[model samples]
Target chain A: MYKLICKDGNAKRGEFTTVHGKIQTPVFMNVGTAAAIKGAVSTMDLQEIGTQVELSNTYHLHVRPGDEVVKKLGGLHKFMVWDKPILTDSGGFQVFSLAGLRKIKEEGVYFNSHIDGKKIFMGPEESMRIQSNLASTIAMAFDECPPHPATREYMEDSVARTTRWLLRCKNEMNRLNTLEDTINKHQMLFGINQGGTYTDIRVEHAKRISELDLDGYALGGLAVGESHSEMYRIIEETVPYLPEAKPTYLMGVGTPANILEAVERGVDFFDCVYPARNGRHGHAYTNHGKMNLLNAKYELDDRPIEEGCGCPVCKNYSRGYIRHLLKAKEMLGLRFLVTHNLYFYNKMMEEIREAIENQNFASYKKKKLEGFAAEQGN
Target chain B: MYKLICKDGNAKRGEFTTVHGKIQTPVFMNVGTAAAIKGAVSTMDLQEIGTQVELSNTYHLHVRPGDEVVKKLGGLHKFMVWDKPILTDSGGFQVFSLAGLRKIKEEGVYFNSHIDGKKIFMGPEESMRIQSNLASTIAMAFDECPPHPATREYMEDSVARTTRWLLRCKNEMNRLNTLEDTINKHQMLFGINQGGTYTDIRVEHAKRISELDLDGYALGGLAVGESHSEMYRIIEETVPYLPEAKPTYLMGVGTPANILEAVERGVDFFDCVYPARNGRHGHAYTNHGKMNLLNAKYELDDRPIEEGCGCPVCKNYSRGYIRHLLKAKEMLGLRFLVTHNLYFYNKMMEEIREAIENQNFASYKKKKLEGFAAEQGN
Candidate 1:
């Protein structure tokens, strides 16, 4: 259940209650692909960094440790030892992006596994079944994530097929929840809206999925090579069509700036790999933009990654030591940066929610954007 | 100051007071090769894992961050945020083993660095200067680590030259300790005993270095391709010659069984890379021997890595989940295993110390060795 506490312009301050726990929107779900955060972070570390939700990739989990394997171990919560809400993406995006030699049909998509090159078929039912087995708090609908700049005709057919797949996904999820062996009997499904860059198709798809009354709604395929302006415009034009009572997730939607813009346009939930990925590359997110710790300028600087930052990394380590670790190719360097970046994202969301509730989101967003551009020009 | 608290046959229970803190006897110093524990462990994690002393490589630190850089940043303790006692090895071992195109002389060795192939020279004074800059609580004396199977003549010559280097190391450390700008003004030096596998030369070298009245003495160059019995014989012969009242360290010495044997032979300190190295390879150290998490049989095993183990990893994570993470090539898997393994070794040291204090080290060693061999025949 999502309760709209307040709003500042289009920015939303809401609370989402799930079986696991409550999530205060707009929440940035930490991406823990393959059941673990990429840079040696554990669920124990997540709590310390103020993480509310952990997001795992269904495609990766299904590929390596099968969903049945996770089910046998008592679902993802028990498997990862994370008790908070977990949002698992449908295998749709990875099936289109990562898998090789994929064939898309009306029933489903057939693709070779990225890991072992084994043939696998995943339709709405298969995707739903896999998610049901993993039993996350929120399962995304299996929809084709069309690439940006796709033709109107291709996107039209894809969105129609995705809508049909959403219906099948809802029905399958309902059946799985009613089953005796289901790990999470109350597993919720979030329908994703995909229309490439077409506003008409996006709005239409959003309206169409809105009527189906999913537990949540998501705007997908917007950040796939689309310009920032274009993504914002599409979000502004399409968000009004999504139900305000339901949680709105921006699937795979990006950086600190991108999240702030989405939140301004009423996005309530987000999951991205930018923090973890950039951190692995020694980039740290700060209020005043990103700091590349590998820079020689930090070789003798004893200050933390960000001065006055309250993150665990900032509280204990210095830029010089972390720089040396990166130069030495140590894993702790990546872990520290990743932990800090995720905290930066999650903490920004807390500020965003407070700003929205205080009816000062416009000023908060302006200052945050300006701050990101304040140091080293981002 | 080194205080011999008690003795159980050859096993001595003692405590060493350093500028940093007190280190209990039979302690296993966690090796953090490059100043940071590999496997993404930090100083905070070190404290949690019962790590009393941290061991770092002088060669690795000087090669990357440079000793001067650490000095400028307030030494290794502040640099790594570890307040516990740290033991730094001289550049001798790596200069012999890792460096390329090395030249050994009466003064020191000149070689190309393993990292960037840059020419470098390190003598006894240079090693002392580097450790003084690193400011570790305990610094090792520079000595040639002769390979196993060396002829008696070569072993005798190497041991003699090492003794001369030990004298030079002592004088330089004394000068560094008196210097006003030195990071660790009270840095203590531990002389290394090197005589290949020749017990006669080993005992002679141990007797010579023991007369130097250094803070501690380490049995180096053992466990370097020698048979277990041969290494044990060398330790048994040499340790008796070394001062029983001072702390005895076994450098680069190995496994749980190896530690037990060395402790039985009156070794008070040990350091090795097995736990961290094996962990990176998906191997976990347990009381019932080692468990390879990458094995197919652990795919669905939901039990902890070790039953009744109080380490953080085993407290919350299951073997099945850790196996999945390892198979997915996740760093958390390695971190988990490494943490548990270090805790296992450190916890075992605690047990060893208690057993020695209780005057039951013999029976304790028997039961522990039997327990280790009880499962998996490791």
Candidate 2:
């Protein structure tokens, strides 16, 4: 169960009560793609750095250690030592994006593993079962992530198939919750809405999923290589159709700037690998802009990555030292950058919630967008 | 001035009162090769994780940022945001190992920068002046780190040249400290004892440098490719010749097992890149033995890297998650390992100090080594 703690116009400040803990709304789930955040951020570090939720990939866990193995080891939370709420994405995205020789049918998809080329089958039921085995607080319904430039006919067919899969996911979740072996008996299932870049199709699909009355609704298939305006237009058109009472998650929608925009349009949850991934390339997100630590200009710049930022990296390390690490190709440099980026996103959400509570969200949104756009030099 | 606080057999506990802060002896200085720990550990993380002294390379910093630039930016402490003591290496080792077109003369060595083929000159005075520009608490004397398997004649000439360099280093350090333009007026100098695996030459060099009455004395040439037993034998033979009242630092003298052996042999200070370097490769030091996170067995292991490890990583992360991060080539994986390894070394030192205090040093060393050896077989 969750409660709407506060609201300001289209924006909401809420709390999601889970078995593990409660998560504040407009929260950013740090992406731990394979049950660990890339760049070595541990669950403890995540907690210290103010992460509310950890999002793990059902596909990666299912492939490497096997969901059954995780189940035997007492679920993903115990395996990763993350006592906070964890949301496990349905393996559908990876099946579409990472797997080889994928064959999609009405029931499910059969594909070869990207790691070992081993045959694997992932349907709605299989994804639900895997999430159940992992015992995550939130399990996403398996829905085909359609290609960005998909034909209208293909988009329509994919949405219908996704709706059917959502039903199977719901039924499987119900069965798993009743099973005594399940680690989280009260696990919540969030249904995903998928339609390729078409607002009419997206709104219709969102309306259909809203009727199912899932715990939450996610706007999927937008950030899959579409124009930012097109993605924002789809969200703006379709979000009103989703249940206003439930949390609206924008799956894999990104960046500090993107989150601010999405939150202004009323996205309550978000997850992205940008912070951890971009950190590996030596790019750190600062309030001014994304600073590349590899740039020679930072060689002797003794300033922190950002002033007035209280992250551990910013609080004690100078840009000069961080630049040195990046130049040396040290992993610590990446870790520091990723840690700062994640902290930046989480802190931005806090500020967003504060603005919402103060009834100044409009001003806050305008200011933040302007600040970010200024960094873009447009 | 440094003061010897306590002594139990050959194991001594002491404190070096520096301009920045007091440094506790039998201390391990965390190495920041390029002004940053190789893994994403920053100065703030270092402080939280119990680091007292940080070591930076003179060669790398001079090459990349340039010493003149660091001086312009208020020296390395302000540059790195570490207020505690910092020790800058003389660039002698890196110049010999990493630089190109090295030419050794009685005055100094001329070499090309490792990053660019630009010609550079570094003698004892230049090394001391660069460290003074960086304003590190302790500046290591510049000395030629002779290649292993050198003939007796070569080693003798190198040691003699190193002696001349030490005199120059001491005189330049004094001159820089008195200069009004110097960034660090209180900078201290530590003379290096280099004899390249020859104990008679090492003893003579140590005695000669001891008469210079420098702030500290360091045994520099032991770890550069000599067998462990041969290095241990040299320390056993030469340590008695070094002044008992002054602090004795062993440069780049290593692994947890190696450190324990050195501390027992009356070495009061140590620095090495092993913890951070080995960690990036997925190797972690545990009380048991070094555990490789890349091993398949760790994939489902839910325990911390060490059971009682109080570091942030061990407090909340599982071996399983760390293994997954390492397998994924994540920087966070390397950071966690490095953080844990540094914590392990520092904690071991604390334990060693405690044992010495309780007059149980002998038994503690024996038991710890036995346990470590037994775990290696597993």
Candidate 3:
């Protein structure tokens, strides 16, 4: 399913094939938590922006329009009208973060739904079943995401519990993928590595998860609240222990600069909500830095968001016009920036992949870092 | 210039040419009050949905971004990135309806901005100047829109003052169009007919304005709180007095059936915010009636809003999906419905024009009224 094509130092270029389509390496998955991107972006717009994959949250889908509802309507791919491959995150992250009164136990975590106060229980088996019903191309194994700044003992215990949970998730996914009623019989699973800034725990967790022979590997809980140097240290320490023949995904790790850094360290897949969320607030990502359209300096500035950016918004609309729309509370303001930001991210990935294939990724990374002066979003 | 193609009874099939583009007769102008459709529908989306002319509000533009800001950025058409013909409403309707602390006189009306409560005055010349800065294909003459229950004496005086304002507007627009830096040198002006509900006063006002040789004439303030019968009665009594060579616009007068009735009474142009505003609230205009998507029964209906509706939304998405988006408070829900409804209205006008050309408008109108059961909007 994963074929490595070339490598420029640690940056490897590969093509991952799924039933839906082939995704290029260094790909950014557009986040559509509820099957529709926030700020009114549609699947059609995603295709126009060169999105190779869509990442949706299992917690959100399971809450509002239940997983069964999506299954009845023919899964997330059909529901969203995107024929591209889809990746579904395990319900663990949102269940831990969003749900109130969450209780942790070996059987499952009992919690109240974030949308309503309805009590719900989700274990490894439950998350696997939901993802099976959602019928995405890639399903993440359910694991508890430990909070940041944990003691070494707590990190050790959490990693151990996550490993046992991964085993259960793997068994449940294998069984669910073969059931006659399963929407996607060939669904792939990728186990997440969690160790909260501990190199030994991360390496041990990565090695144990790689033994399952999953389709991909993901470094989760790194960008949760860790500093850049710590995240880089953990990734550099843990990646060597994993079976890197498979695709490596950096879950929820962000920013244009972050992507460049991760690609250099061999992270293949990424998804973040920054572009869409920041865009709704009138922040635009430009090559110079991040341009906030709400700033009064752009009131009469007729230039596009950037001089040579080829996104449709920048190609047709001026910074002044978009700024006015944002000031006036027009929805197009959100849409224009969202579309442009996504296009910028997607184009950035394409350039990164090209640089990797050409064996010049280091120079590309250096040039990009030199140009971007502003701090990327949290 | 207005070229009368043909007439089937009072429903005429004509074409009106402006410097920007030619608009087909019996056309519906999509209302983009702040240079944007309320539901985040973009100019690109409008083009795909068959929008002929975009009607923007001079008051909203002048208050929010300020018309001077738009001119500096490029003008309404370029700022909004719409290449089609645009018609701007004079800052008169909103001044009376939306502004506070308003005082009326022969020179102009002084009121506080609805947004910031900042003091601002607008007269014939001020309105013309703003419209010129917007550089729309057509501009409306400034006139008072009296309340619904005004006395006959009040109506007569208001009509007389409107005529005096019309002369001033004509003088100002003529001079503004010839200005060296004017974006639209050939900007056309449409004179408005307002006499409350008095048929005699309406006829006299319409006759007086038609003599100005304006590019078009509009019947304003009729739909401002009047009964459907009263508005229809006013259109029937007043349209005959307007010039045959000019396009007669029914400003803000609506409903699918209301439009048919006005077309039969010789009205040729229309603009209203109902389609977009209703769509934002999940009300869909179907051939049968207005269907609200927020109703819970559509949860798993798995059907399009209307069958045999040749809209992009209808062709690609299901009512069930759109309902899910709406229930989840997703903006795509409003966008899909807005695009679908506008396409529906534009398609309806096209069908209306075809029926007029075929000399079967009366039958078409009769059949349509029988089918639509719900009231359009308040």
Candidate 4:
């Protein structure tokens, strides 16, 4: 269930309730691609950092540990030891992007697994089944993520096929929920809107998917090499057609600046690998842009990653020590940065929510963007 | 200062006070080579897992980030954010073993660093100066670690040189502590006893070092390629010559069984890489022997690393989940196992101390050894 608490212009504040827990939005779901946060972070660390939701990849879980194995071990919640709500994406994106030699048909797509080069088939029903086995709080509708820079004709065809697949996924999910053996009988489905850079196709697709009255909607395939202005324009054009009562998730949309822009355009849920990935490379996000810990300038600097921050790493460690750790190639350096970066994102979301509730989100967004720009000179 | 609380035969229960903190005797020092526990664990994690003393490598720190850099940034205690007693080993072991083409001389060993292959010299005074810059609570005396299978003549010459180095180390440490700019003004020195596996040489070296009345004494060069029985016999023969009032450390001595054997032989302090190293490789130490999480048998086993264990990992994670992480190449798996293994060692030492205080260490040692042997079938 979704509750719209307040709004400041197009920026919306919301709360999403699930079987696991209630997540306050606008929220950033920390991406734990394989049921564990990369950079050696645990669920306990997630809780300590004020993370509300965790997003895992269905494709990765289905491939290595197998969704069936996760089900036998009591689903992703018990498997990961986190009682917080989790959102598992449909395996379509990974299968389309990561797998080798894929052929798409009405029944399903046939491709070889990226991990082992083994053939596998996944249709709407199969994706739904794997997700049902994973039994996450939210199961995304299976849809093909069309590559960027596609023709209008190809975009139209892909959107049509995705709509049909969404229908099948909805039906399969309803049936699966009624089964006695289903792990999450109340699993929520969120349909994805895909139309590449074509604004007309995106609006049409958004309107069509809104008719199904799903629990949530997501704008996917937007951050795939598209310019930031084009992505923002597409979101502005497409979001008005979707129902505002449900949550709006922006999939794989990145950067603190991008998040601020998308949130202003009414995107309520977000998940990206930039924070975790960049953290591994020794880049730490701060209020004043990003700081690379590997820089020699921080060798003798005894400041936290960000002064006046509330994260555990900031409270206890110094940039000098962290720099030493990174130079020594200690994994804790990456872990520390990851924890700080996630906390930065999560805290920003909290501030965003507070600004929306206070009806000052526009100024908050402007000042936050200026803060980053002032340091990054972008 | 060392206080003897009680004793059961040779096993002693005591407490040693340092400037940083007081350490319970029969303590196991968690090896944090290069100022970090190898398996992505932080000092905060160490505190949570009840780690008493953190042992760092003088060689590793000197080579990377450099000890001078650590001093400028405030010292190892602040550098690693650990306030507990830290014991930095003299660079002697690493120079003898890890360095390339080392030439041992009376002034000190001349060799190239293992990391950068930079030509460097580290005699007793140099080792003391580096450790002083790091500002650790206790610094081991710089001494050569004689290689195994050495001729009697070689053993005698190496031991004589080590004794001379110990005298130099004591003088340097005392002078460094008196300096106005030294970070740790009251730094303590622990002399090392190294005579290969020859009992007569070992006894003479121990007696000669004990006469210096340093804060502590250590038996080095025992666990290097020697039979377990032979190593145990050497400990039995050499520990008595060292001062019973001061702590005796068994350097690089290993395994749960090995620690128990050494404890029964009157060794009160121990440092080894076994728990953290074995854990990174998927080996977990338990009361009932060691379990390799990489083994296929643990794939579907839904049990903790050890049931009824008070470790944070055991309290939250399952063997099945950890095995999944390992198979998927997740660092959290190694981290969980390492935390659990260190807790296992620390908890065992606590039990040993308690058993000694209760005056039943012999029976306790027998029972603990039987527990490990029963599962390992050794």
lDDT of 1 at A222: 73
Displacement of the residue A190 alpha carbon in candidate 1, Å: 0.7
Per-residue lDDT tens digits for candidate 3, residues A59-78, read: 99999789998999888888
lDDT by residue (A112-219, candidate 4, tens digit) is 999999999999999999999999999999999998889889989999999999999999999999999999999999999999999889898999999999999999
lDDT for residue A298 in candidate 2, whole number 0-100: 79
- Per candidate, the number of residue pairs that clash is 0, 6, 0, 0
**Docking class for candidate 1:** high
Of the candidates numbered 1 and 3, which has the greater lDDT value? Answer: 1
Worst 10 residues of 4 chain A by lDDT: A369-378
**Candidate 3 ranges with C-alpha deviation above 4 Å:** A374-378, B374-378
- B1-378: candidate 4 lDDT, tens digit per residue: 999888889987889999998999999999998999977899999999989999999999999989999999889999999999999999888888899988888999889988889999999999999999999999999998888889999999999999999999999999999999999998999999988888999998898889999999999998999999999999999999999999999999888888889999999999899887888788888878888888878767778888899999999998889999999999888889889999999999999999998899889989988888776521
lDDT of 3 at B306: 88
Show model 2 residue runs off by greater than 4 Å.
A5-9, A286-289, A292-300, A375-378, B375-378
* Each prediction's whole-model lDDT (CA): 0.92, 0.86, 0.90, 0.92
B225-284, model 3: which lDDT tens digit per residue? 889998999999999999988899999968888899999999999988888888878899
Chain B alone, TM-score of each model?
0.98, 0.98, 0.98, 0.98
Candidate 4, residue B155: lDDT: 95
User: What would the per-residue lDDT of candidate 2 be over residues B1-378, giving only the tens digit for each residue?
Assistant: 788878778887788999999988889999987777766676777887888899999998898778888788888898777899999999999999999989999889999997879999999988988899989999999999999978889999999999999999999999999999898899998989988888889999989989988898899877888889998888888888888888899999898788888888889899988897888789998877888889988777878888888997898777887787777676677878888989888888888878887888889999999878775532
Model 4 complex DockQ against the native: 0.81
lDDT of 2 at A224: 81
Residue A372 lDDT, candidate 2, scale 0-100 = 64
Backbone clashes (count) for model 2: 6
Better of 2 and 4 by TM-score: 4
Error of 4 at A373 (Å): 1.4
